[model samples]
Each structure stands twice: as C-alpha cells, then as structure tokens.
Target: MSRLTLAGMALLLPGLTLGGEWSGYVEGQIRAFTQEPQFDEQGDSTFSLAFEPEYYQSWDRNQQSLTFTPFLRLDSQDEARTHFDIRELLWIYAGDRWELHAGVGKVFWGVTEALHLVDIINQTDLVENPDGEKKLGQPMLKLSFEQDWGTLDLFALPGFRQRTFPGEDGRLRSQPWVDTDLTTYESDREEQHLDFAVRWSHSLGDWDIGLAHFRGTSRDPSFNPVVNRDGDLVLAPHYEIIQQTSLDLQATKGDWLWKLEAIHRGGLDDPFNAATGGFEYTFVGVAETDIDIGMLSEYIYDDRGDDAPVPFENDLFIGLRFTANDVQSSELLTGLIKDLDSDALMFNLETNRRIGSSWKGALQARFWIDVPREDPMHAFSSDDYIEISLARYF
Candidate 1:
C-alpha cells in the first residue's frame, strides 16, 4: 500500500491502522523551596529538563503492532535524579479473542484515589516524583484471554528492578542516604529473579471488579543500616521474596463514584492486610457556570498499624477537584492526608493549564504540618516547596 493511503487508513481506524507516527514533549521545571534545607549539602532550589519521545507503527491487517518510547532527564542539583529509561518498547499481536504483549511496558492496578495499594507489576520510579504515579517499564510476556465469564491475564516477568532513591544532595531524602551498591535480595538470582502474576477482571452493569495475585521478589524494600567508608551510616535496600493477593473494585452511579483497593501480603516477619477505600461526588455545571467540582474522601488502614514499616498505617485523605471546562482544559486538585492517631498533616496542591496550542504550564506545592518527632515524615518538616514547569509538544 502507498504511504499516503496507509496514513489515511490510520486516521480512520486508529488501533487497527497501518501507518507510523512520532510524537513527544520537552519540559523545563524549577523548584523553589520555602525554607532552608535541613542538610548542609542540600540546596534551596533546583532545575531540570526532561523529554519523552514515542514512535508507533502497525501492520498485518492490524493484528500486529509495535511501540517505542524513551525518556531522559537531567537535573541541575542531584546526580542520582538525572537518568534515562525506556518507558515502553512493546510488540503486540491481537487475535479474535486473545492478545499477546511482549517487551518492556507499564501496567497499573488499583481503584482508590488516595493510594494504589495493589499496583505491583512495575517498579516505582521514585526520582521522577514522590507521588509514586510514575513507573519504570517492566520486561514481561503477557497473554490475555477475553471470555464471557471474565477477562484473564497472565504475566511472566523475567527480571527485577530495584526501586530508585534520592542521593545525598537531594531534597526530601532520608536523614541517611541510600547506598544502592550494597543492595541485597532474598532471591538467589537477585535482579534476574523471575516473577509471575495473574489477574481476572469482569464488568457487571455499573460495577467493575478485579482480583489478582503476585509471587516474586517484592518491589517494596526495607532499609538495612550500614556504615560506609567515611564511617557514615547509610541505608542499604533489602529485597524480600513475597506473595500478595489483591482485589480492586469500582462502581459508578450518576454523579457518585466509589472505589476500593485491598491487599493481603506475606513476606516479612508476618502476614499483613491493608485497604484503601474512597468515594468521589461530582457536581456538574455548578450554579449554572461552566465549572465542575468534585469532593473526595478515603480511609487508609494497615493491620500492623503504627508498627508498619511505611507510613499510612492509619490515615484519612480528603481532597477537592475543580475543572474549569475551558478550551485550554484548566484544572486544580488539592488534597490533605492526616494521620488518624496524631495531629500530623500533609498537604499537596496541583494546578495545570494549557498556555496555547503547543505549550502548557503546571504548578505543584507540598507542605508538612505539625509532624511528630517519631513519624517517618518528620524528616521533611522543613522541606516545603513549590514546583513550576512549562512544556512544549510536537
């Protein structure tokens, strides 16, 4: 087929098209701190440049296709934050009732807005953001079957990826930095450890449900204190072998949406159960204006309570979302998470709007309030900062 003809078909058929395209975005960001750094090596401000480019093509009557996407970032202050990664490099084959996906890709699982407790397929790319919204591409071979009963997906992952951490000169870092070189894994194969997962999903009327299980090297690691060459204490990550079962569900009813995510894990000292549930109620065209408002609330619980290694053992999350419904798609989201046991509070604000046809701008701010000395977040009591970014798409 001619290139012009294939392009025309691609526009009409989308996923089942027979053409190639390239697109990406370049962004520049600056973060300004509201207070002095707690550590001497830390700085008051930082700047970064990031780029992500994607290429996609499909052929063979749309039964086969491939996508390649790569990401790169350069940070002015933290060397550990400057990195490169292949976000996706996937080859897929689609059949009448089944599909196969191969290569590196990203997958997400969970329903609650406060926390994605069951998302375990890919490792967290912590350097990108502390929110855990970004993930590193996972190398896997996934086979999915679609049936009347439900959809089933099987995953065979070949390698493990250790979670990333900020360096000594980075902000929002632990008191003692992490020494990744000394990282250890419970699996004999270390990074080469193989993992497996399966998920069954179904939709019934206004409800969607998913049940999944994973067995392999755990993505969440514990820190082991070690003394470095300078006799300074540094934490080394230790990966544990673990098994987890999770269930996620969501229901839609008019302007109200409900979500829940729960998980049972066995790996460390003893088994533990955790859950996060939330609801969002949206008001459309509020007061006869072209604006919408959404109210959200969630509860986070861990059976281990305060003894849990990570935070969010007993917490409550409340937030509000606003949409201007303008031509440029302006939006704002603000949330507050409070430890149920004490007066500790964490607040986050995010807003974004399009500048023009090809340009966009965003702002984010984070603050810690009345954090107790023993809380894990106490280390960042003075790390309040505001971040701004501008991006151009092509």
Candidate 2:
C-alpha cells in the first residue's frame, strides 16, 4: 500500500464512524501475451486482483461533504505492479457563489479522446495501464468561484507523486530497468516543492471552453543511463520543474462533435508546443437498429517533431466507437495510431458490458507493429497482450 493511502485511512476513520455511505468493487484481471517476453525474467501471462472502495457523507443540508476512496491491486507476476493508492479522500464545502475543497483528489482536463495533451494536474499511474488513463490522487487545497463570466478554480498542490514504472521482471520495458531509487529532482526541496494551478471554464451555446496554467514539478520524467551500485546499467529518472499553459475546447452540433487540446510547456531541454484535435460523427440508429456507430479521426502534432520522446508526435489516430443502446450497456472502441514520419504503429481495442445487475466484464487488447529500433515503443514490440477482467460491485 502507498504511504498516502495509509495516512488517508487514518485521518478518515472518524468520518467512517459518522454513518457515511459506502460502495466499492473488487475485480480479477488476466493478461495473456501473444508472443514470448523480450526479457528472460518476464513471463507470458500475468494475473492480478484489485479492490476499490468508496465512502461518502453529506451534512448541513448537503452543503458540506466528505468522500474517501481507496484502491489496491495485488499482482502475481511483477512486484512493482502490486500497489495501492488513495484515489480520493476529500472534504468539500459549497456556498452560494464560492466553494472550498481540501484533501487528495483527481482532476481531469482535456477534450481529445485519443490523447490528453492538456491533462497535467495529476500524475499518470503508468503501472495500471499503458493508455495513461489512470491517475494518482494529488494533495490539494482548492478554492473556486462561480461568477457571471465563468468558473474560476484556484489550486494549491502540496505533495508530488513520482511516476511508477515496471520492474525488471515486468513486461513492456526496455532491457535495462529503471532504478527509481536513484530518482533526482530539479528543486532543492524535491517532493516538498509547492505546486499551483488555476483554471477558468465557461460554456457558450454549443461550445465549451477551458483554459488553465500550472507550475511545479513535471509529471513526466527523463531517464539517464547510469550504473547502479551493483555495477549494473540502469535508467535513472530525473524530474524537472516546468511551467505549462493549456486549453481544451469542444463543440457539439447535433450528432457531430469536435474536440481539441493544446499545451505549451517550458522547463526541459527547450520549450515546445503540442496539440491533438479531432472530430467524431455519430450515425444514430445504424441500419434501423438501436446500435449507434461513430467514426473518429484525430491529428497529433508536436513542435519537436521526430525528436520528441513521446510516440504520438506527428501521428494520426483513427478510431470507431460502437454503442449498444440496450439494458446491458455494451460499448466498444477500436483505434490505431500511425506515426507519420516512421513505420511505428499501435492498435488498440477496448470493450465492456454489464454482465448482470451487479457484475461487469471488460476486455482490452494492444498491438504494436513495424516499430523500428529508433522508436521508444521498440521495447514493447513483443509486449502485445490482451487483458480480461470481471468486477463485482456492491
């Protein structure tokens, strides 16, 4: 378990005894590889069990509230994959025109479906998934004001979380493992560095717009090859302080949707700008059936171009989304990203359905093709795998 999770549980114990409501889910996951692992210590299959529970309470005519959420996962193969986190443990106060929030929470900021370029408030939980959808909760004190112009949110982030990486025995990694123990920080205070962010969001007719800025430690890290005390070559992570400005905009017109996320960041080797924009058109009641099909296309661009470390630079993303307007709530999404400057390609498919009143099932698959050695994804050339999971909710 994480130290934050433990501390949160201790602090929220009194709230739990205050007759709060509770809900949660437990799930088991199975991952099967399509090919042999690239490393000798890796395996072809892995299994894990995860649990996430939430507690919530409201008082004072619903103006004050408390929410506590904790997550845990135990992996059978990789020790680094077994971890815990405090997804949310917060207290909120809502008044007529202003609000206050204190504790650990998760915030999402983006409009693009393929890539979330403007989402930088919370660090990515890389061990959970390669898609970078999962995030770690951040310790924050936030104040918000709703005025005639828009909603303004001010955040004071106190603690920073390091990005998680796979272990030596884990899949989807290069030959040399990352030595997290050797992590370095640009700030003298390291993890104690204070971070801050502000955002303003408003809606106008069919358009929604949000602008935000943040300064502090960068969630993303750069790796330097070094020799550990054991005389083994490894990658040491180094965190840099950064300042970023971002924008997310979306327009909804009938069955068509347009989205964009853009960001300009400074504090690394050089300042760079990145953006992802796309459009989705949905065909309602396809073929006179209740199923709806949507076509998605997005363009990803980074000013650094081919030299960027991220794989999505100068790439195109094409996807299809299927929705079954049924009682079971079944949905499917399939997509592929192709590097415009090289042969690197990534194909992904994800689907989920409600099994029963209290059960759900999901499947996810990833494939990499034509990944050249120069590409960062070349390490995952043989890491294509499928994951299946079933969850029981209460």
lDDT score of residue 296 within candidate 2: 99
List lDDT for all candidates, in order: 0.88, 0.90
lDDT (tens digit, per residue) of candidate 1 on 242-322: 999999999999999999999999976789999999899999999999999999999999999887877788999999999
- Pick the lDDT winner: 2
Top TM-score prediction, candidate number: 2
Clashing pairs in 2: none
Model 2, position 365, has a per-residue lDDT of 99
Tens digit of per-residue lDDT, candidate 2, span 5-61 = 645654664333466789999999999999998878999999999999999988777
Specify the poorest-scoring 10-residue window by lDDT in model 2: 8-17
Q: Residue 273 deviation, candidate 1, in Å?
A: 0.4
Clashing pairs in 1: none
Q: After superposition, how far is residue 387 of candidate 1 from its true place, in Å?
A: 0.7
Looking at model 1, report the run of 10 residues with the lowest lDDT sum.
1-10
Clashes (backbone N, CA, C under 3 Å), per candidate, total 0, 0
Query: Which runs of model 1 end up more than 4 angstroms from their true locations?
Result: 1-19
